[model samples]
Target: MTTTPDDLAALLASVESDERDLVLSTFTHDDAWRLGCLLVELADERDLPVTIDVRKGPQQVFHAAREGTTPDNDSWVQRKVRVVERFGASSYLVGLRARAKGTTFADQHQLPLQEYAAHGGAFPVRVEGVGIVGVVTVSGLAQGDDHALVTEALRSFLGR
Candidate 1:
């Protein structure tokens, strides 16, 4: 079924709290690598042509498996990451909220559309009480699919 804005909002509410509750005490490069590998493995099992990116602040620890993906997918990843970093929330959630408020992210936040994307597939890596530390992103699928894939991977990784 196609996800509506309300569905997206519900998803955001359900997952964001879990994400906050499941934060790592200390997120390391090894953690990023493992998470990235899990994302890639899951995507490959589904034969998805997606790029997986795991970043800690400005440092990208893992980026892999861009099968059937283009440079545009990389750009989408960066844009989605910008949205997550700016809002400290999942990119899809942000977009859904924007739509619910009857505005676009660029119009509502006055951010350049070229720089920030409110599309899916970018999730904040919240470090327990430390707040947002990084982002995990995937691209090259429908926006909701991208978000769902990352969310599912994170849930499995966090054992939530």
Candidate 2:
């Protein structure tokens, strides 16, 4: 399903406060590894060509299953992470809001496109009382699919 600004807003509202808070509480090297492995297994089962990354600040905690992905996917992950880190929201939500406003993140925020993307698949890892601490990202799927994949994985991981 194509995601609109409203849908993206709902997703952000659903995840940003509640889900992110809970998930970040469980954040750790082991949790990141498990989350990465789960994403890999999901992608493998679905025959998806994707790369998964989970990072805290500048430190990458876990990465898994780069299948049929190129260097471009890595770059996308970086860019999308930049968006999540900068905005403290999901990359797809940012993209949808920008589109709904008839603007692009690059043009609207005067940001470099090469360094920041507004596409999907990167979510802020926000703590309950602490705020954003990291990002979880996926690349090599359609924008909505990438967003959904990360969201679903977070839900499953958090047992929500």
Candidate 3:
């Protein structure tokens, strides 16, 4: 079903809450590995065709792709991750805010679609007080589904 404006409003609010509440006390390389693994496990359990990526700053900490995925998934992950890196927010939240203003994210921000995709899936990896130090991203499902999957993994990993 197509999302109504009220649905969009509620979704935007939920995503904002996820970004705010899903904070790590401190993120290490091990934390990235474990979190990334948890995401992959969740996808595998549901037999999802997707790719997962976790990055700390400019460095890739973990990555995985399910059997049905392709190189395009990698491209999409890169684009979504770029959005989180640039804006310090979940990609879906950015897209929703732009939509609420009756504009596309690329047009509103003057960002090229090729490099920065303000789509769902990429979420900022925020520390308790350090702010966004990395990103966790998933690609392959519908944009909103992709966002939800990542948030679900995060909430599980964080025991929230």
Candidate 4:
């Protein structure tokens, strides 16, 4: 689908709003597990083929792959996680910011494609005062769908 500048602006605003509003009081390994499970349930309910990953710092706390996912989905999750780790923003937000600046994410940041991806599906796990503690990522759908799935799960998990 073609994204008009207006659409991009609105999406960017929504992602920024999510980052600002979805702060957890605290995030723990248990919290990651709960969040990860929520994501899986949401995807499964919709019959989405996706791989989900939740990381606490450098340690992966939770992971799940739905039946239709391929190994490539895992790689996408990792790459999207790197984007969140490096930028402390949602992967979709990073990509939107790049587009807003009239550049591709890789070229704008000079990041290697194999190591980082500024695509949708990865979101920073932020605690109220602790900043970004980890990432929650999903892959296998269209990038925008992946992002929406994660955000929707976050909204549900956080009771937003």
lDDT (10s digit) by residue, model 1, range 132-159: 8889999989987998898888878887
Model 3, position 138, has a per-residue lDDT of 97
> What TM-score does each of the candidates earn?
0.89, 0.85, 0.97, 0.97
**Pairwise lDDT winner, candidates 3 and 4:** 3
Query: What is the C-alpha local distance difference test score of candidate 3?
Result: 0.92
Off by over 4 Å in 2: 1-23
Whichever of 1 and 3 has more lDDT, that candidate is 3
lDDT of 3 by residue, 42-110 (tens): 998999999999998889999999999999999999999988888889999999999988889978999
Ranking by lDDT: 3, 4, 1, 2
**Which residue segments of model 1 deviate by more than 4 Å?**
1-9
Q: Which run of 10 residues does model 1 get worst, by summed lDDT?
A: 14-23
Least accurate 10 contiguous residues by lDDT in model 4: 40-49
lDDT score, candidate 4, position 30 = 95
The per-model lDDT (C-alpha) reads 0.86, 0.81, 0.92, 0.91
Among all candidates shown, the one with the greatest lDDT:
3
Q: List the residue pairs that clash in candidate 3.
A: none
Candidate 4 per-residue lDDT, tens place, 24-133, comes to 89899999999999998888788998999999989999999999999989989989998998888999999999998888998899988998989899999988868999
- Models, CA RMSD each: 2.1, 2.7, 0.9, 0.9
Q: TM-score of the candidate numbered 4?
A: 0.97
